[model samples]
Structures are given as C-alpha cells and as structure tokens.
Target: MIPIYKPYMPQNIGVEISEILYSGQLGFGKYGREFENKLQSFIGAEYVLSVSSYNIAMLIVLSTLGLREGDEVIASPVSCLASNQPFAVKGLRVVWVDVNPATGAMCPDDLKSKITKNTKAIFHNHFCGYLGDIESINAICNSFGIPVVDDGIEAFGSQYKGRKLGNLGTDVTVFSFQTVRLPNTIDGGAIVFKDKDLYEKALLIRDYGIDRTIFRSSNGEINPDCDIEVEGYAGLMSELNSYIGTRQMDDINSLLAVQKNNAAIWNDKFTNLDTINSLKITAGCIPNYWVYGTLCKNKTKTIKDFKEQGYYATGVHINNNIYSVFNNNVSLKGVNEFINHFVAVPCGWWFENK
Candidate 1:
C-alpha cells in the first residue's frame, strides 16, 4: 500500500556517501560547513545553522533567546508537538492561538488578541507547507516589538511573495530535514536567523558554547585553550548527514515540482466531490504541498476507503493542548474543527504518478 510519506533520496546518494567515507573525517567538519553555506545561499538567509534534528534546532533557537521562566509564547494549536513543546521545556508558558479555519494556520486577529505584557514571542507554523498570513502576523508582532519564530518544518521549498519561507521577515525560521521531509538527511534540521548577532550566538550554542576556531595562531594553527560562556547542547549535524543533505539539494527543485504537480492533480480531482474540501492557500503564497490534505465530511470513513484502495491516509498531528504537559483545556473552535475533518495523503516525491 502507498504510505502517507516517504523520504526522497537522490540517485547519486551512494556516491556522496562513498566520498565522505573515503575522506576519513566524519565529524561536523568540512561537509557540515559546506552544507550550511549551500543552504544559506539556497534559502537567501543571512545565516543558517544545521542541527542534528528539528527538536534540537528549536531548542537551540529558544535557548539562544534567553526567555525567562513563565514568559508566554503565542503559538497555534494546530501543529505538531515539536513546534511548541520547546517553549514549555524552556520554562515558558504557551498561549494557544486558534488557526484559520480554511488553512490551519495561526489567525492574525487571534494572535493580536492574545498578546499581553507576558507575551515574549510569537510562534507560527506553516502547516503542511501551506503558507500562512505571515506578513500580517509579522506586522502585528513588529508593532509590539515581539520576535516571531517560524516553525517552517514542512515549508523548506515554499515561497511567499517571491521570497523563500526561511528568508521571510521572521526573526528566526526553522526547517526540518527529517526522513519524511522534503530534503531528507536521515535526521537533521536548520535554523535561519535574521539577526547576525543571534546567528553568531546560535553557532556557539550548537557546539557546547565553545568556539573551536576562536584562538588561531598566525599560521592558522588552532589553540587548545577555549572559553565556554553559556550552557549549550551537542546539536551539531554530523558530516555524513550533511553530505547526504548537500547531495539532495541538487535535485530539490525537481522534487518540489513533482509534489506541487501531484497536489494540483488531487485538487482538480476532489473539486467536484462535495464530501471533500481542499485547504485554502493565502494570496501570493506558493506552497510545497508536503502532504496533500482535505477536510472530509466523514474523515473516518474516508481514511478507511483510501486505505482499502491502496492509499495510506491519516491525520497530520494531534493538537498539543490535549497533552497533559500543556494542560491547556481551552477550546479553540478552528482547531477542534480541524482535528476532526483533516486527513492527509501522500504528496511527496514517491507519489508523482497519482
């Protein structure tokens, strides 16, 4: 049966791995640096930091911000736990914001209403690569002098008004390179920063807060002594994963093109069906269509029918508020409606034919 999602591997991935094995250096070295440089150029970001996983990438971004305990961060209730859990783990309170009924994205009006003195940051997710009303949300956050962190895990190749997702005006944008994502590297992710200073801080945080090349001699020889200023985590991307990701970048455009085409096919096919409703896209937003989703009148029966027809379909994620750690019993009308009707089918590279 066709699965809901599968990792896309380049045809020459074996060659890329062989080169890394022959080099004898497998830590976060040359390939890692190359990957970051290539990614920065690709996404047009001022700075990019590659991390081991999306969760750790979020941790690095939140930790670098130095948020205080009990500080409230406004986030959508329609995202995966990884998107908002980092705030709670960092001792910050998560204020659930309702999503747009049509797009499953943070509602700018609701986001504005949730802001208070305790609100430290605004966290927005590009659900299933469908771009949200980021410009409006960013404008609201900018008016309040609050930073916005974009959880753009499924939107690596997506665009908004001609700019890539990560290059958008958000203060910090995170992208996932997990196995099921667009540009898979087994397990890796990236963080892009708009501020140069924050980028520098994140670099240190990714490697245990120690600068390995801080004290180079006149001949470029490294100094053994280093200074550790702040607590950090081992979140560096391995050289092997970096090499694999770098190779995949070569065919990213083609991969995204196929996903987009397949989504268009599904859109046309479902247009005449009254039982299924396609998700809406904002004006000037170009989605990558990570997972083609529709709001079905009878989602349970629809999923069973799809499986019986040799297609795998399922809900994208459970709302984080339901979990005990969040302890958020608040009712979000849009989120409740979304959780009941949304169902996703494969829209990745593997399902180009359908």
Candidate 2:
C-alpha cells in the first residue's frame, strides 16, 4: 500500500551519517550551524535556529513573545496538536479561529473579530501546506501590534507571493523537519525570526538560557562571571540530526519539484469529479503539496476508493478545539463543515519514486 506521507533520504547518505556517529563531536556543533545556514539561504530569512523538534520550536517562539499567563491567543482550530498545544503548556489561553470551509485555512474576518485587548499573539496554521490568507491575517495582527507565529510544519518549500513563508512579513515562522516532512532530519525543526534581537535571544534560550560564549573561559573551564539571565530550555538539535538535515537540503529542490508535479496531476484528477472538491489555494501562493486535500461528498467512500487503488488517504488531523485541555468548546461552523468532508491523499515524493 502506498503511504500518505514518507521521508525522503538522499542516496548514500549513510556514509556521512556513519562518519558523524563515530566522531567524538556528537553534540550540537558545526553541522548544526551549516544546516541553519542552508535553511537561511533557502527561506531568505535573516536569522534561523535549529531545534530538536517542532514542539520545542514552538515553545521557544512563544517564550520570546513574553506572553503572560491567561493571555489569549487567536489560533486556527484545524491543525496538529503539536501546533496548538504549546500555547496551553505556556500558560496562555487559546481562542479558536474559524477557517474557510472551502480551503481549511484561517478566515481573516473571523480572526479580526476574535481580536481583543487580551489577545497577545496569533497562531496561523497553514493546514497541510495549503497557504492561508496570510497577507490579510498579518494586516489585522499588525493593526493591533500583535505578533503572528506561522505553523509551517508542512509548508517548508512553499512560497507566498514570491517570498517564502518564513520571510513573508510574519513575526516568527517555524518549519518542521520530522520524518514525513520534505527535508527529514529524522526529528528536527527550524525557527526563523523576522527580528534580529529575538533571534539573538533564541540563541541563548535554546541552550539552557546560558551564554555559551561567556560560560567558558579560553581554556574551556567554567567561568564564574557568566550568569544565566533569563529562562530557557535545552532544545538543541544533535550534530547527527543536523548532518542528516544538511543531506536532505542538498536534494530539496528536486524533491519539491516532484511533489509539486504530483499535486498538479491530482488537481486535474479532482477537477471534474462530481463528488470530490479540491481545497482552494490562496491566490499568488505556490504550495509544496504536502498532501492533496479534498472535500468529498462521501469522505469514507473516497478514502476506501483510494485505498483500493493502492494508495493511502484519510483526514490528517482532528480539530484541536475538540480537546478539553485547550478549553475551547465553542462550536465553529466552518471548522465543523470542513472537517466533515476533508480527506487527504498521497501526493508526495513516495508516489513518484514508486
């Protein structure tokens, strides 16, 4: 059976991976720095930080925002738990924002209505790599002086209006490099900062809030003058994972090309289907097509049909609002309508390789 998602590995990467494994320097080092540099060049961002996972990446982004306890954050209900759970864990309240039923993306109108004095930040999740109305969302957030954090887990290679998602005027954008992502690091993520100061702070906080430069003296001994000024976490990516990430970056362009072509084929296939309506991508956006999302009249039957054809398909994520931990019970009309018909099918590198 074909998989809905699969990690891409460059041919003969084992030699480099094996070399890194046997090397004494297995911690976060040169490899991690190289990975960040490649990502910076690809995404066209001024500053980028490599982290252990997307969850930790979100945690680090939120930490930089200085949000207080019970601060309300407007967020899309249609996203992975990893995308929204970080808000609750950071002692912030999540205000559910409705998505456009046709596209399964955050509706700018709903987002404007949800904004209040208590709203500190906005979590705009680009569901399954389909670009949302980010320009409009950013406009609204800017008016209130609120920061926007983009959950670009499935949108690494996607572009919004000629600019990559991370540099598309958003305050902070985070991308996942998990196994199923386009550039799999096995398990890793990157955070891109639009602000240079926040980028510097993230550098310190990602490694236990200590100043690595001053923590040790010239002889590598612990320096007594060095101090831990702010709160932080140990969220550094290992050198092994960083080496793997760089290998993925080496072939990222070709992999993205195949995924885009497959998505085009699926778009044509669903165009005339009587029961299957393809989700609408925002204007002026180029999606990486993590998976081809559809709104089927008979969701169950559509999934079964795909399975019978030797492909895997299903709804990728449940609405985070359904979870009691989020404390958001307000029923969202668009989210309800979208989830009931949403189905995702394989349109990644695996299909072409097969």
Candidate 3:
C-alpha cells in the first residue's frame, strides 16, 4: 500500500538529537532561541516565538486580540479546524465564510458581505500553500481597522509576488512544524508578528511573562520571587525539538523541491484520470504542496475504493461544525462540501517513483 503523508526524519537526526541531549540544555533555551531567530529570518517576520504546539500558538493569537463574547471572527471554513478552535474557545462567535472553489481561498467579496459591526477580525488560511487575494483581504481589513489573522500552517514557503506568505497583509500568521508540514519538526509551531511590540507581548504571554531572564540577581546573589506578571503557559519548545526543527529548516528548501516535483508528477498523472479531477493552484503561487489533497468524484466511496486498491487516500481534514454540539446549531454548506469530497493523497513518500 502506498501510505499518505509520511515524515522524512533524515539519517542525521538521531546523532543531532543525541548531541543536544548530551549538551544538557535539552529544554527550551539556546536551541529554541536559535530556532526562532532562524525562522524569523526565513519567514521574514520581525520576531518568532517557539511554542509547545500549534494549538497553543492558536490560543495565544486569539487571546492577544482581547476578543469577547458576541464578537465575530470571520474565518474560512475550508481549511483545518485548528484555525478556528482558538476563536471558538474564546467565546467569540465564528462567522464561517466560504472559499472560492477555484482557488480554495476566502473571497474578498465574502469578507465584505459577511462582516458586520460585530466582526472583530477575519481568519483566512492559505489553502495548500496558495496565497489568497491579499490585496483585497488586506484593504478590506485595513479599511475597517480589524486585524487579519492568517492561518498559514500549510503555507510555509508560499509566496505572493515575491514576499513570503507570513509577511503579506496579516497582523499575524501561525506556522506549524508538526510531524507533517513542508518541513516536519516532530512538534513545534510559531506565531509571527509584524509589529515588534505586539510580537514581544506574544513572547511574554507565551512564556509566563518571562523575557530574557528567569531569575533575578541581587548584586551577584540569586533573588527569589522576582516574578513578572501572571505566569502564562509553559509553551516554550524544548531545546531538543528546537535543535531538530532548526536542522529541519536547513533542509527545508531541498525537501520541498522534492515534494513539489512529485506534486507536478501527480498533477500530470491525475490529469489523464477520467474518474478524478486534479487540484489547481494560483498562477504565481508556489505551493509547499501541503498534504497534496484532491477531491473524490464520489465522496462516500472514493476513499474506500482507493484503499481497496492499496492506496492510502482519505479525507484530509475535519469539518468543525460536524462535531456533535454543532450539528443542529449551524449550517455549514461550504464546509460540508470540502469535508466530504476532499481527499488527500500522500506527498512526501508515497510517490511510486520517488
């Protein structure tokens, strides 16, 4: 069977992890700092904070906005639910917006139509590392002065015109270095902020208000109980993970080259299939090819038929509105369409010729 979405933990990782363990700085410290800096430069963001998980990053990004109940956050229902979970948990009403079926991106017109006075912000994902209509998304958000929080988890190297995805028109963008991404890091995520002050606030909020120091020194003596503000979550990524992620970043470009090359091959092959439709991308957009998903001609039985032939195709993501409590509460037409027909074929390691 050709399994889908496998992590390519290279040969050098074992030794590298061993060295980090031996260094005794195995927790979040220098390695995390180094990793964050590298990531900041790579994504062209002002600052990056290494966090425990993308979920934690999601939580912080939502909470930092100071949203309250009844406040609405317009979000594309096409992408992963991790993008919306934070907002939902914060008591903000999630106004589900549909994506353009062609680009799989949130329509700027939809943003204008869906946003009411209660709308606090808009959350849009770069579906398959393809940049959305940033000009209009930016202009609309800026017009209302509401921030745009982009879920760029799948768009690590995606670019628009020339600039990286994270830097384009977003108040902030969240990236995941999970076991499956353009470059997998086993477990890590980051929140990239354009403004230095907002970025530092996120940094403080990430690490229990601890910034650049843990314990204070009184004339060379240790000063205890010199606490800063309310201690936040222990969201710092461990040094071991950071070391792994840092090393992973070094090979990211080459790794994605392979993935994209393979995606082109898959796209060509799927073109001849009368029974399936190949996915499409924006003209100038270069996808990280995150998951390399496609839709089944028949939603219910396509996955089963594919698996019967020893292929590991399945629905790529979950529809949040289907999670028990939401069944009768809201109607998600676009979300339903995506979750049903959308199928993800393995990218990194499943290519027959790779």
Q: Judged by lDDT, which candidate is best?
A: 2
lDDT of 2 at 216: 93
Q: TM-score of model 1 relative to the true fold? A: 0.95
* Candidate 1 residue 99 C-alpha distance from true site, Å: 0.8
Pairing residues by index, what is the TM-score of model 2? 0.97
lDDT of each: 0.87, 0.90, 0.74
Q: RMSD of each candidate?
A: 2.0, 1.3, 2.8
Off by over 4 Å in 1: 215-225
Superposed model 2: Cα runs more than 4 Å off: none
* Lowest lDDT block of 10, candidate 2: 345-354
Candidate 2: tens digits of C-alpha lDDT, residues 1-354: 889988787788778888888998899999999999999999888799999998889888888887767888999989988898888898789999999999999999999998998898998999999889989999999999999989898899889889888989899999999999978899989999989999999988898898887999999899989998877988999999999899899999988898888888887887888899788889988988889889999888989998998889999999989999988788999999999999998888777733
* TM match of model 3 to true structure: 0.88
Tell me the TM-score of each prediction against the true structure: 0.95, 0.97, 0.88
- Which prediction has more favorable TM-score, 1 or 2? 2
Rank list by lDDT: 2, 1, 3
List model 3 lDDT by residue over 1-354, tens digit each: 877767666565777778878987777888788888888788887766779888888877766676676677888767777766776667777777766664577778877988888888788788756677877888998989889887888788887777777877588888887887755668778888877877777877787666546556757554566566633566889988888788877887787777778788778767867567655566666677765767667866878887887778877666565554322235655556656667777666436434
lDDT of 3: 0.74
